[model samples]
Target: MGAVLQLLSMAGSVLGFVFLTLCIASGLYYISEIVEEHTEPTRRFLTRTIWVIEILLLLLLIFDKFPIKLTIFAMGSHMLYYQNLKKFPYISLTSITFLSSCIVVVMNHYLWFKHFNEVDIPPQFHYDPNYVPPRRATFSQVSSFFAICIWFMPFALFVSLSAGDYVLPTTVEQAKKTDEITELNSETTAKLRGRTIGLARVVIHNVRKYIYSVLALFGIQVQRDYDNLGI
Candidate 1:
């Protein structure tokens, strides 16, 4: 088990380095895209957020006490929030970056849980042993793992965007303003009955087709898979 753990740690370290490089390369691309360095506040915020996340991941890989549960939750939260935020101010590059981060974060969690199944990784941090799923977590492990994977990163990103941490100034007042703006927009939409109906139908059609395409490509039943995963 010790030797297996060592190998896993080494593999994780290598993967971490690769991820870091990818982050740096991507960051440069983002920075170069900025017309006015000071004007694009969200770019700065996102750069910092990505670096912080990368550092956190690296530290976890290095020390083996990276707070897997908390990190998982944070990553998921960020992903969820960012997805919703695309509706507000749609920047294609930033949106792409957010989506990419989401994919990477989810993949990391999935890989971690998948690897945990093959080898007993020493607990990186102290958690209630009772909180531990089981010696061989198997299906319960993957299910819980993905549950966090699905929701936490996106939600965290959402919080960041709402607070403006991913954009500019993430403060309470800013959040209130955002809320007001969003509410005002919603109210305006409410008044456009005919347009709203048209918009709703268009959204429904696009969403339905998109979902059907995904389903057809990946098989239609998700619930059964969750059950099979022991959810």
Candidate 2:
């Protein structure tokens, strides 16, 4: 009986996680739609936010005794992210700028994860256990810095940027290819769009479809119509 209860509890946790993931995915999809509607304004805001974060990083580097190499690299990563803004919300996945941005996102996460786990990553001054820095980062300070300066823009981009694959039809052949719109690799659409689509939208669409399929098999009905990934 205890073993059975344990198994049931695990199953419940798994189910809860899956449900929560789907909900978040749906929210991201909705946010992406709103971002599509406000592309220009959103682009400007992201640009300014990048500038602000870069300034904050400089402040930390000079004042907080943050590791110099890591701070510089972080700033450089932000620059790469900024490059994606030229085309604004539409991104070419094959582009070097987009690929570099993705790399830095992972690198930043990995660096911060290690930084937070270890002490004395700073200069020699940090080894003096008795002497605390004048402007040491407290829990809230670091948390906010991590959330806003480090992670915020990347997360925002994930929810805002669309792949360039779904292009506005230009040619007569493309115009007749309504069926190609749904495909990721339709030659006409891919040629015109250059392979851009909302990365997050695609994920949300597929996730919702999978969840709906699973629920349907169990006689559960999902009311949310995510047929076009919230369009």
Best by lDDT: 2
Tens-digit per-residue lDDT, 65-164, candidate 2: 7889889988999898888888877787788888889889999988976876675545876667787644545789778978997899899988878865
Which stretches of model 2 miss by more than 4 angstroms? 1-16, 120-139, 165-197, 211-224
Instruction: Specify the highest-TM-score model's number.
Output: 2
Instruction: List lDDT for all candidates, in order.
Output: 0.47, 0.78
lDDT of 1 at 95: 57
- For model 1, the superposed segments whose C-alpha errors exceed 4 Å read 1-83, 86-94, 120-134, 148-190, 193-231
lDDT of 1 by residue, 1-231 (tens): 699999999999999998996676455334333312232365346545545654655565466553476566555555444454454223233556666765666666666665565654457635646555445545874576455544444433432332111222333355466675344565553343121111122233355556667887887744322111110
**For candidate 1, which ten residues in a row score worst on lDDT?**
193-202
TM-score of each: 0.28, 0.71
